[model samples]
Target: MGRVVAIANQKGGVGKTTTAVNLGASLAVAEQRVLLIDLDPQGNASTGVGCAPGSVVRSSYQVLLGEVAVEDAVLETELPHLHVIPSTPDLAAAERELFGDEDWATRFRDAIASIRMQYDFILVDCPPSLGTLTINALTAADLVVVPLQCEYYALEGLSQLTNTIERVRNGLNPGLTIHGVVLTMFDPRNNLANDVAAEVRRHFHVYETVIPRNIRLAEAPSHGKPVILYDAASRGSYQYLNLAREILDALPIQAA
Candidate 1:
C-alpha cells in the first residue's frame, strides 16, 4: 500500500501547500506515483498543480459527501505520475455535516482505502488549523510531514500540534507517527530565523533540506504551477527534490 503522509502545520504561511505541491511534483519526477490530496478548503494544492476551476467542480467535497468515488475526483497534473483530488470551497462545510456522524474522523481514511494500493505515496495538504478537517486527515494518515516556518512565533504552535497528534495516535490511529519536520522559508541573514531553526533542530527530527525563501516559489502558485515546473533550477525546487529523496530514503518498504 502507498504510504499516506499528511503535510501539516497548524500555523498558516508555513509552506504547507508549497511543500505538498512541490514535493509531490519532485517525487513524481523521480518516477514515484503520487496522489496529492487537497484537504485544505483553500484548494491551493489543486491550483499549484494547475487544476482549473472547471476541473475542480467535482472534488474532495463530493468524495467526502459520498457523491463520488475517490477515483472519480482524481485529476491529472502536468507531471506524469502526479495526480490530485482537488478541493472545493464546499469542503469547508463538510465539518458541520460530518459532526453528526459517529465516525466522522474516519471518513477520509475509509474513502481512500480503495485507492491506497495504486500509488507509491499519498500526500495530503491539510488546512492551517487543528479542526475537524485536520482531524480527519490525521486519522487517515500513516505519517505526518510538518512544514515549519523558520520563525519564533512558528515554534509556539508546535507543542499544540504535537499534543493533538499524540491524542490522535492514542485514540484514533495507533499507527500514526511524525515522519519529520521540514524548515521552510529560511533566510540565513535573519538571526531570529536561524535561532528558531536551531531550536527546532534541537528538539525535533528535522529533514536535511531547508527550503529557502525564493521568489520563484512564491510566484508559482499564482501561475498555477509548481516551482519545479516554473523554475526547476531555483533553490526552492532543488530543496524540495532533496526533501523528497530524504523522505523516500527514510520510508520503509512494504511487501506486496
Candidate 2:
C-alpha cells in the first residue's frame, strides 16, 4: 500500500507546495514511484512539476466533484517515476460544491483508494486554509507533513491547524498523524530563524533537513522544474534531496 502524505499548512508562503513538488520528484529520483496531488487551487505543485494548471482540461476539480476517476485525471510528469493529479483555479469553488453532502469529507479518500497500490507515495499539496478541501485532504492522508517557515510568526495559527487535524483524526481518519514538520526558508545569518526553528523542534517532530532560503528554490517553479533539475548543485536541491531521504527512512513501511 502507498503512504498518502498530505503536505499542508494553513499558513501561506511556507513552502508547502514546494515541499510537495520537490520531495515527490526526489523520491522518484530515488527509484520510488510517486504521485503528487495538487489539491491547492493555485496548482503550484502541478506547475512546479511542469504541468500547466490553466491548460489542464481534467484536473483535481473534476476528481473532487466525482466527474471523473482519479486515474483519468493523473498526468505523467517528465520524471519517469513521478506523476501528478493537477488542480485548477476552479477548485476554489470546491467547498461550495461539496456543501451539505454527508460524505463530503471522504470524497478525496475514495477517489484515491483504487489507485493506492500503484505508487509508493502519494503526496497531496493542500490549499492554505482549514476549509472543506483541506478537510478532505486530511481525511484522505495517512500522514501529514507540515512545512513551517522559520520566522517570528511561524507558530501563528499552528494551534488551529493542529486542532483541525485532531478533529479529523477523531472523527474521520483515525490513522492520520503528523509525520514530521519541515523547517523551510531558513537564513542562518538571522538569529530569529534559529530561535524559531528551535521553538518548532521543541513542540513537534522536526525534520533534520533545514531548507535554506535560496534563489534557485524560488526560481525553479517559474521554469517548470524542481530545484534538483534546475540547479543540481544548489543548496535548495541538496536540502530537498536530504529531506526525501529523511522522509523515506522515517516511513514505517519498506520502500517498494
Candidate 3:
C-alpha cells in the first residue's frame, strides 16, 4: 500500500499547499506514482496543479459527500504518474454537513482506503484550520508533514497543533505519525529566519532540507506548472526534487 501523508498545519500561508503540489510533482518526476488530494476548500492545490476550478466535473466535495467514489473523482494531470482529486468551493459545506454525523471523522479514511493501493504516494493538502475537514484528513493519514515558514511567529501556534495531533493519535488513528517538519521560505540574509530555523530544529528536530524563499517557487503556480517543470535548473526546482528524495529516504523500504 502507498504511504498516505497529509501536508497540514493549522497556520495559514506556511507553504502547505505549495509543498504538497511541488513535492507530489517532484515525486512523479522521479518515477513514483503519486496522487495529490486537495482537501482544502480554497482549492489552491487544484489550481496550482493546473486544474481549473470549474472545469473539474467531479471533486473531493463529491467524494466527501458520498456522492462519488474517491477513485472516480481523480483526474489525471499533465505530469506522468501524477493524479489529483481536485477540490471545489462546494467542499466548504461538507464541514457543516458532516459535523454531527457519527462517522464524520472517519469518512475520508474510508474513502481513501478504497484507493490506497493504487499509487506509490498519496499527498493530502488540508485546510488551514483545525476544523472538521482537517480532522478528517488527520484521521485518514498515516503521517503528517507540517510546513513551517521561517519567521518570528512561526512557533506561536505549534503547541496547539501538537496537542491536536496527540488527540488524533490517541482517539482516532493510533498509527498516525509526524513525518517531519519542513522549513519553508527560509532567507539566510534575515537573522529572524535563521533564528526561527534554529528554534524549530531545537524543538522539533525539523527536516534538514530547508526550502529557501525563491521567486521561482512563487511564479511556477501562476504558469500552471510545478517548479521542476517550469524551471528545472532553478534553485526551487532542485530543492523540491531533493525534498522528494528525502521523503523516499525517510520511508520504510518496500519492494516496488
- Regions more than 4 Å wrong, model 1: none
Question: What is the C-alpha lDDT profile of model 3 across 1-256, one tens digit per residue?
Answer: 8888999899999999999999999999989999999999999999988997689899998998899988899988889899999999999999889978999999999988989889999999999999899899999999999999987678886767888988999999999988889988888899998888888788785887889888999998888788888889988888889999998988886664
Error of 2 at 150 (Å): 1.6
Q: lDDT tens string, model 2, 211-237?
A: 888999999999999888999899999
lDDT score, candidate 3: 0.89
TM-score of 1: 0.97
- Per-prediction TM-score, please? 0.97, 0.97, 0.97
The lDDT of model 2 is 0.91
Error of 3 at 243 (Å): 0.7
Output the lDDT of residue 108, model 1. 92
lDDT of 1 by residue, 1-256 (tens): 8989999999999899999999999999999999999999999999889987666667887887788999888888889899999998889999999988989999999999999999999999999999988999999999999999887687789988999999999999999999899988888899998888889888889998899999999999999999999999998889999999999898787755
